[model samples]
Target: MALATLGVVVPGIAAFYEFVVKGRKRLGYRVQMDTTATNVVETDDPGVFDQLREPLVDPTLVLLRIENNGQTHIDEDDYAVLHDKKAGVTITFPDRKVVGMVVTELSDDGMRSSFEDGGGLAVKGSRILLPKVPMNRGAHYKVLAALDTMNGKMDQYPPPKVACTIKGGVTGGKIQETRSRTGTPKRVIALIVFLVAIVVAQLVVFTQSNNGAPLDCASGHLNVTGSTAFAPIAREAAKSYQDLCPDATFGFDMRGSGEGLQFLDQAGRDGKADGQLTFSDGEKPDDMPGLLPRPIAFFLFTLVVNKDSGVADLTGDQIERIYQGKITNWRAVGGNDLAIRLISRNPGSGTRNAFQRRVLGGVREPGTNSDDCRNRDPGSPPGVVRCARDSTDAVLRTVESTPGAMGYSELGAATGRAGLTAIRIDGHPATVDEADHGAYPFWETEFGYTAGEPAANSLAASFLRYLTNQVGADIIRSYGDRPCAELANPQLCRPT
Candidate 1:
């Protein structure tokens, strides 16, 4: 009877390890594609392949994908290698020599810097060494390697031998060599189906126990209205929340920040504020007693100029002078002799308010002079051509089209736009790291405002909780903003 119990208990433990414990810190790798099957070596004309400097007798291209296919994040310090060792894993191609390798794709652009020269990504002999890259859940990167079979026949292409010499810090962790999607084993498929069914059953039980309401879910409609600069993050977060809670819905009315606050104020006075929410670029006014504020993230803003401007950096004094109409032409600031056009946001814009408070020293700029922003208005002075735009997109478009035009916009909105360059301030780039270290000043604390506090179980309250959680923080960081909760100094998000 003891032996029989041991037999059953051992198998149960094995199944639990295989299905549950094994996936918590898994490092999965797979050969996405091998060019051996399609190699047609034309020996007569080697000149056709001039793209490679080194001549190859028998070339094979291998695309390898390495991922953190696990539930938790894998930090760089989690690698189980020596302290001085740079490589986390070494992949060997038997009977083949590695000619070159390049990182092809990344799940997140922030991982690109990890593949730089000193990050341990190198090709030595028949092996490719990889760095200890930290990966969040579902994050992956692809490396495309050019390999030669040492003049061996290409017909018998041996599979790669992946060894985790550089990647061993995980508990109960083993680096797995996975097959292609079509070659997945039947037993693995059955196990996955079984685990999914178990999870579904648990979820059903949990919902039933909670009186028919799902975890972290509220059934209602919410209207998210606020800073157009933060609209991208807001929309993404709302979409993710709706996906998690199918009964919930969201409507967006992203006007300027001040406008959004005023709209929420009126909604609160009318007792319709329960369904309305607004996000501001900074703190709300002291006059609005009923409204409550919660800091969500730190948004970075930058000054952008047309490509023809030839100016890259500006001092705070120079910017203030330009807005104050003391400087007129681009040549005055070491650029071409073109006339300077100022594209600015309107009075109700929160971004404009932040700029005035932080950069302009609480001083307001001269009123908008030109309606078209090209030439001065008929009765206005013939100095700087100043105009006001209602939204961040309008400011960027105007700065992109008009030569010598300059404007300020959210960093994410200004990035990668053609014909405009995001300039620096006092030689400091507009980056989260820079802002954290106090080198950058063009940023603001983004706040989510409600009309007093919504009920604990209300949709507005639940959505606010979700916005500060890990999922919403990821979405916020993806757009180049830094969530306040993740800040090195949490006090930075507080009202000054």
Candidate 2:
């Protein structure tokens, strides 16, 4: 009888440790500071109000910190409130009315837009409402609001209360008060607790594990198409995903981003959108109705030149002048005296769009005048010869073999090619860290677009989930791209 009891209780404890203790997702909050306006007014001091407005009555200010103090990410869908109840979280001040509010601080500057109007931030009577803001692990923001008495009485009221009423998904939906930290000690404590829990759990139970299999796996044939810049990542990720799910298969159509999106648009119209998807170096066109975009990563691009050119860095002005047909020779830009050859991509390429938007300052590149990338076409007035390539690999190859040739390619694709150098812009190297800090300018948010939202259990959705998860993030980072999941400013992943 005692053995039977131990068997059941031990398994229950192990299950609890696995799901509740180790893998739990939590959202925590803390009221760091609260003060009433009346407390600061002295006997003879003027009240806290402008002459143009009514004087504040028992007006108070609150500093509230909300964070994803969880082991996993909290996505926008995780917020239980949706449809009719649009606010994700609600803060109530009993007997008080909210006058104004502002976001005081954030873990990432990318979060700033979330607090603006139309982001679902609203004030009604005594309640402050917030939109369904997605937060990565340890991401946080602070809200500062001014509150006044609703009944015009100067009497003190009860403290404010936060109710995380919309609890849905795997996350611990409710936001509860937690201890405020001013430094890194909170991380230290969390680490120590995690270590202790792991040791104790191992000692108490011998549990069977699934050997690191994916929890979300769907089997189906999916068609993928997209930017040549992003094709390598898509192919590699698809192969790995197939390894895990034997029944799943993927077909690729390596076309430019615009072409892929066009295909997806037609697929939607034909009722075959569920099994088709495309990846782009940037956002798809607005005219492609019914397409849903999921951000993937921040991909960096670089200007590559043949080593014989001897040019290491070019300023933004020089680049613009080059594309503008003003600078024609390598010697004009501090390089060897070789005639410049410009290798460009077709207009349909998303890489070309990003290059024009980010590096060319919203200007279009001059039309291709050379078919072979070696000589200009008849009747084309030229100082430098220019041509277009259909794929990233072709661009790299062309730049490598032609002296004084210059072209742009995805950072990963340009890293180790022979006879070519990945030149920097304004002396800043193409790196994720540099791009995140505004030092590098040739980066764009990568996106995955579908005709419509795939069913939760469909292969299209599961493959996307895999690309954004930890395993996929590791793969993405290995190729010199920064996955959206790890961005401090997640908003950067959203196409502008």
Best by lDDT: 1
Global lDDT scores for all candidate models: 0.80, 0.79
Against the true structure, whose TM-score is highest?
1
Q: What does candidate 2 score on TM?
A: 0.59
lDDT of 2 at 187: 60
Model 2 error, position 286 (Å):
1.4
Off by over 4 Å in 2: 1-213
Which sections of candidate 1 miss by over 4 Å?
Answer: 1-214
The alpha-carbon deviation from the true structure for residue 323 of candidate 1, after best TM-score superposition, in angstroms, is 1.2
Model 2: per-residue lDDT, tens digit, 123-234?
Answer: 7778989777778889999777677688777556777898774244343345667897763344643443344334323322322223334557688899999899989888
Cα lDDT tens digits, model 1, 1-496, are 9999999999999867754666466678999767641225656543322223433566666778898876667877767787556688888999898765667679988888778645678778899999989888789897767667775666767888887732332345667876657543456434433443343345336645546444788889999998999998899998888887888999999988999999999889999898899999998888788899998998899999999988898898899898888888889989888889999999978899888888898988679888887888899866889999999999999889898899999999898997988888999999888988899888999999999989999998898888786467767876788878667887899876
Q: List the residue pairs that clash in candidate 1.
A: 80-169, 88-166, 88-167
